[model samples]
Target: MLGAPLLEEASGIGALGIDLTSLLVYLINFTVLGLILYFMAYKRIIGMLDSRSERIRESLEEADRVRKESEEQQESMQKALDDGRQEGQRVLAEAREAAERYREQQAEQARAESEQIVSRAREEIKQERDAALESVRAEFAVLAVSAAEKIIKRSLDADAQQDLIDEVISESNAKQEQD
Candidate 1:
């Protein structure tokens, strides 16, 4: 019995099928409140948040780009360093080989020069020996003729000189055979 008026009011509204004017007024109120909130609060707050988010996103993208570029640069520099080291090693090896070859060539040249010097010395000794032997032979001929004239106490005839030379040659040959 106490809920009769409230129930009747609810039933009366249901029977009338809803108040168009009140509905219109409520919609107008809600729309105005939404507009005010959007203009006064939501728009500003959301705009600040959006701008901050955009700045952060741009900064992150920039950081990523810089990081990628830096990594690429570092890799390139490392490759260059490796290449430089390889080139240096190759040059050093080539230089060492060249130096070794040069040293060997010099040693061979020195050896050839020594051989030439020894051969020239031997030839000089042979030439000197031949000259001395010729000089001695001439002296021996003169001495033998002078001694034959003194021993005989007079000049020898050609026939006598020939006989004397034959005897001297026979004596020299016998002495050489004995020695």
Candidate 2:
């Protein structure tokens, strides 16, 4: 009797295009394969994936740090360049000022030298004028004495003539001094 009912159930499942025992076997086989895969490969694959993800995150963090450091370095280099330019400008300005001062000093020195040269020239001209005047006075005195002697047609003794000439020169010098 139990066999008859089981055969009927099998026939019913066959009519539905299924065998219950084969379905049970397939379900058991699928469970075992799933367990095997989970124990043998799934955990390891997941672990590998987790490790890869961690490494990727670490790499991203490192790259970010490097980028930040590069930016800071670039900023520092720019600041240094600016400071160098400012210093160059300052040095150039100082050099220009120094050059201007040097030019002014040279000009002043030249002016002073020119003034000294001019003053020396004036002094020399004055001395030459005095010497020429003295020469002319001496010559004129000698000529006057000679002309008087010739006009009078009288000759004094040499000592007397010399004394008269001396007196005449002294009187002329006195007049010049008074003038």
Top of the candidates by TM-score: 2
TM-score of each: 0.60, 0.67
Look at candidate 2 and give me any clashing residue pairs: none
Supply every candidate's count of residue pairs whose N, Cα or C atoms clash at under 3 angstroms. Answer: 0, 0
Candidate 2: tens digits of C-alpha lDDT, residues 1-179:
33343334544446454667888999999999999999899999999999999999999999999999999999999999999999999999999999999999999999999999999999999999889878877887788788889989898888988888888888888998999
Model 1 lDDT tens row, 1-179? 45344224555447554767878999999999999999999999999999999999999999999999999999999999999999999999999999999999999999999999999999999999778755665566568878867777899888987777767756765775698
Q: List per-prediction Cα lDDT, in the order shown.
A: 0.84, 0.89
| Residue runs of model 1 more than 4 Å from their true location after superposition | 1-45, 152-179
Q: Lowest summed-lDDT stretch of 10 residues in model 1?
A: 3-12
Q: Quote the positional error of residue 129 for candidate 1 in Å.
A: 2.6
| Alpha-carbon shift of residue 105 in model 2 (angstroms) | 0.9
